[model samples]
Target: MSLASLSEAIEQDPVVTRELLHEVARRSGFTVAPRHEAAYLLGLRSSYAIAKQVDLLPDYVDPRLSIVPTLGGSRKYSKPEPDRNGLSAWCHFLNLQAVKTETRLLENRSIALKDTIAVGYIPQTLGTLPHFISSKTEYPHSQIDATVVRRLLLAGATLKGTSICENFSLSPMSYTSIFGPVHNPWQRGFNSGGSSSGSAALVALRAARKAGIKGLDDLGPDVELAIGGDQAGSIRVPAAYCGITA
Candidate 1:
C-alpha cells in the first residue's frame, strides 16, 4: 500500500500537503518546490478567515492627531541618534534646559512668541531643544540636594512662572522600580509611550484632558504634558492610533 494510504489507515486523518513538501526539502537539502506554494496551501484557510474578519471589522473614521504646543519655525523632536550621556541624567535635565533657553530667547525676542515649542531627545543647537522626565521608586542620589534632584527641582520651578494659575505640575511616570510593561492606556498590552509614558497615557485615556491652551503665555511648567514626542513614535503614532485630538 502507498505511504498515504498506510498513514490514512493508521491515523484516519489527512496530512497537510506542506508537511510532505517540507520532508522532501529536508531530505534533499533543497527541492524545486514552487515559491510560496507551501505557504499558500497552509495559510489558504487562515487568509480567507482573515479577509472575512476584516470585512466584518468596523472601519476607523476619525481625524488625525496633530502636533500640539506649536513649536513655530522649529522642527519637532525627531532624533536619529540621541546622545548616550543624555540618558543617565534622567532626560528631565535636557527638557528643563530647553525651556530655560526658550525663556531666555523670549526675553531677547530673538524668536517670536509663536515659535515652535521644541522638544527632543537631544537639544537642538538653535531652533530646537530637548528635555527629560523621570520617575523612580527610590531616589538615585542619597542627598536630595544632589545634582540630579536639584536639576529636576530647578527645572520644575523654572517652568512654573510668576502666575499661580500658569504653574503646571510635574508627576512621576515609568521607572525600572515599578516593574512590568508600561501601562498604555489605549492598548494595555502596548507601551504607555514613555519615559513620559504615563503623561501621554493620561491624555490618551482622557484621564486628564488638555484643559485649555491659550498660547505660549498659557503654557505651564509641565512641558511633557503640554506636548508628546518620543524618539520611537511615542507621541504621533499613539496619538494617531488612539484618535487623540488636542
Candidate 2:
C-alpha cells in the first residue's frame, strides 16, 4: 500500500534489538535462524500510517477539547455521612445540575453513576484501598466524564455523584468494597448484592422511603435513578436482592 508523502520521517520500529528478538524467541519456543534474522528485523520497519482527512470526523466529540470542569460545572461534594449513609452505597454526594444544551428529557431527575463511570473532578476509587491510601500523585480523581455521564447531563439529568462498587469490580457480592459492605435497603445487614451494589442500593433506598415503610429508616442518601455497570449479575443480582427493577 502507498504511504502518505510527508516532510517529517514516517515512524519506524527502532526498539527491535537483536537481543530482544532472541529473548522473545526463547520465551515463545521458536527459533529464528541467524541468517534470516537481519532480513526479518528489517521487514518490521514498514508503517501502517495513513493520510488523514481534514475533516476526520465531521463533528466527533473530542473529550479533551472540553476545557470546562465538567458539563455540570463546578460543584461542591460531600463525603458519605455515617448516619446518612448506613448502607455504604454512596462514595460522594453533590448537587450538580445539568448544563442543559438539549431538550430536558430527564429534567429534575437525580442520577447516580457507578464509581467505575468517571465524573470529572470526582474521586473514582472503585471501592478499594485507594479510598484512604492517596496522595497528589496517586489520588484517583477523574479528569474527564465518561461518555454515559456526558449524555446523561445533556439529557438534563442532575448528576448526583459516583456510588460505591466492589473493589476493582471483581466481587460478585457487595461485601468486598473497601468503603464497607453495601446493605440491602429493604433489610439492613443483608447484602445489597454486587459489583453494581451501590447503584442498586441507592435506587432501592429511594423507593423504600417513598413507600413509607416502617422498618426502613430515612437516614440514607437517595436518588431517583442510578446508572450501573453489568458483567454477569453485577446489576441484576443487586436489583433482585433489593426487590426492585434496575
Each candidate: RMSD: 19.4, 5.3
Q: In candidate 1, what residue range of length 10 has the lowest lDDT sum?
A: 160-169
Q: Which tens-of-lDDT digit does each residue in 23-43 have in candidate 2? A: 878899998898988775654
Q: State the lDDT of candidate 1 residue by residue for 1-246, as single tens digits.
A: 454644344343233356665676679797546787656544543444445556877765332212212213332332212232111111222212223232232221111000112222222121111122224432121111223222332233222111000001121233221222334443445543333342344344443234432231211122222343344444454345434553
Instruction: State residue 227's C-alpha deviation in candidate 2, in Å.
Output: 0.4
Worst 10 residues of 2 by lDDT: 45-54
> Alpha carbon lDDT of residue 232, candidate 1?
49
The alpha-carbon lDDT assigned to residue 43 of candidate 1 equals 57
Total clashing residue pairs per candidate? 10, 0
On the 0 to 100 scale, the lDDT of residue 42 in model 1 is 46
**Per-residue error at 180 for model 2, in Å?**
0.9
- lDDT scores in order: 0.31, 0.76
